[model samples]
Each structure stands twice: as C-alpha cells, then as structure tokens.
Target: MGTQAIIRPTTSQTAPAQEQNFGDQFLHVFLQDGTPVAKLGCGGSHVLNAAAGQSISNNRWTPITVQYNLPVGKQGGSCMIEIATDNGTAQRLEEYVSHPVSEVT
Candidate 1:
C-alpha cells in the first residue's frame, strides 16, 4: 500500500489565532481502486487514521498514530487535532497542540 500520506493544512489566506481552529479536519484514505476506503481521525494528529486497502476487516479499534504535521499560528502557535467518522458527519476527538513559541510576532 502507499506509505502513510501526510497532508498539511492548506493555507488560503492569513488567519487569526482563532481562525486557525481545525475542528473539522478529516483524514481521507483512498484504496487502490481510488475509492475512499476509510475516514479516520478528524483533524490529523494523535488519532487513528484509516488505512485504506490495508486488508483490515475489523473496522473497530484500528490502530492509528498521529503526529504534528505542521506548525500553525505564529512560531509556537496553538493547534488542535480532530477525529471525524460516520461519513464525515461526526467529530470524535479534539486535542490541543503546543510547541515552542515563535520568536517573531
């Protein structure tokens, strides 16, 4: 299967600290057939993301590992990881992200 795909949040316009909230980030994993096999974790980190086409039958409790993919806000900005499931209609997890504060700003 494809090595784990790490996608950083897209930045369209400069946003304020509150605007950087990622309460609806979804990790979409596609199978070899190009069909979205599973929708795991909402935001991105510290959650169990679905492994598409990985021969996983049991849908429950799929092992997942999430890591900080990018730095948000200023240098040491604050961020969050959201878990989404049930056809992207629900949010299951939310966690705060902390890092060294940026020297600038």
Candidate 2:
C-alpha cells in the first residue's frame, strides 16, 4: 500500500505558508503490505535528497505527527516526521528541508 499527501500554503497568519514564487510541497510514501519502503518530497524545481530506509510497519490505527522549526529571517524550513507503529515504538523518519529560489538583490 502507498500513502501520499500534499502540503499547501494557506493565507492564514498562523499557518505554514510557502514562499512566494515557489510551488506547493508534495510527499509520497510507498509501502509493501504495510511495511514502509521509500518516501520522497518535492516542490517547485527541487527534490529532497534524503532516503527513507526505516523499518516501520503498522497494522492498526496509528498516529503520525510532523513538526517543523522554521527560524525567523530564513527563506526555508526543516521538518521532522514521526510515526507510531503497532509495536509501540515511534519511528522517526529522515528529516528534510526545503530549497527555494533565492531572491535577486
């Protein structure tokens, strides 16, 4: 089985907004019978360089959480994803950051 999600920027002041001129973010996770195999994230013209090699699996209802610490004055941000499998261990996936186009001076 496979799962996918699209992270889009909203106009809300407290939401995670994408930089102007950049495209929406995309995430896809591939699994085999519930075992995670690989995942990827891409947006605009850039793709993440991390590899998803974790042996995380679940057969019941699970809770996944993603957290980001976008520093002030920075043009991009980093995120951490965690998935709670049926084994009771929360697996932390590889972290990824965004690479947006730099503004010309």
Mark the regions of model 1 whose C-alpha exceeds 4 Å error after superposition.
1-71, 74-89, 101-105
Query: In candidate 2, what are the lDDT values of residues 23-102, reduced to their tens digit?
Result: 24444333333333222243344443222333333333332322222211235545434433233454554444455533
lDDT of 1 by residue, 1-105 (tens): 111332222232221111122354334443322212334332334343332222222223333222223234533333333322222332223344454332312
TM-score of each: 0.24, 0.36
User: Stretches of candidate 2 above 4 Å error?
Assistant: 1-24, 37-74, 94-98, 101-105
Itemize residue pairs with steric clashes in candidate 1.
Answer: 25-42, 41-84, 42-82, 42-83, 42-84, 43-82, 46-66, 76-102
Model 2 global lDDT (CA atoms, 0 to 1): 0.33
Error of 2 at 97 (Å): 2.4
TM-score of 1: 0.24
Worst 10 residues of 2 by lDDT: 13-22
